[model samples]
Target: MAIRNMTVATRSLDADMTVDEFKEWLRRFDTDRDGRISREELRRAMRAIRARFTGWRSRQGISYADADGDGYIDDSEVDGLIEFAQKNLGLKIVAY
Candidate 1:
C-alpha cells in the first residue's frame, strides 16, 4: 500500500480522526500512563491495529520508530511511529 499523502492517510483513519486524535489514540497504548509506550506496549498496540508483524517488538517494530534509542517511545517519537505504521503496515490511526 502506498501512502501517497498524509491528508489522505489521515482521512483513511477510522472516523477520520485528526492528527491530534490519532496521537491520543496511540496514547491509550501507554498502559502505565507515563506518557510513553514501551516496546512491548507498542507491539500489542500494533496487534490491536491488526498489523502483521513478526519477531519480538524490540528487534523489529521498535527499531523503526524508537528514534531516541531509549528503548521506549516518547511523545516526540510518536510521529515516527505513525509514519512507520502508514508506510509499512498501512495502519490508519484513529481515536476510539
Candidate 2:
C-alpha cells in the first residue's frame, strides 16, 4: 500500500468577528453602494484586508462568491463568501 500526502488548502481571517462584521468588511469594498462587489472592488478589498490578491486570485474569488453567475457578488451572495471564509479559510465568524 502506498501512502499519499494530502495538502489541505486554507486561508486565515485576521480576527474573530460576526456575520455583521463580515458584512462590514465587504462594505469597505463595495464602493459604488450598489450592494454588490465587483471583481475589481473585491480585489481592492482583498488588498486592503490581506494585501494578497493577484489578478487570477481575484477572479477566482469573485467566481466563488458570485452565485448568480452575474459576474458580480450581490448581497444575496455575501453569505457564500462568509461561509468560505469561515469554513475553507478557517476564519471564525459568528452567526447573526
Q: In model 1, what lDDT does residue 16 have? A: 45
Worst 10-residue lDDT window for candidate 2 reads 1-10
Best by TM-score: 2
Please give, for residues 1-96, the per-residue lDDT of candidate 2 as tens digits.
211231112123444666775677678778789888898887776665454444666687777888889988888898877766555445577764
Taken over the whole model, the C-alpha lDDT of each candidate is: 0.65, 0.66
Question: Each model's TM-score?
Answer: 0.68, 0.72
- In candidate 2, list every pair of residues with a backbone clash: none
lDDT of 1 by residue, 43-71 (tens): 76666655555346435657888897988
lDDT of 2 at 36: 85
- Whole-structure CA lDDT of model 1: 0.65
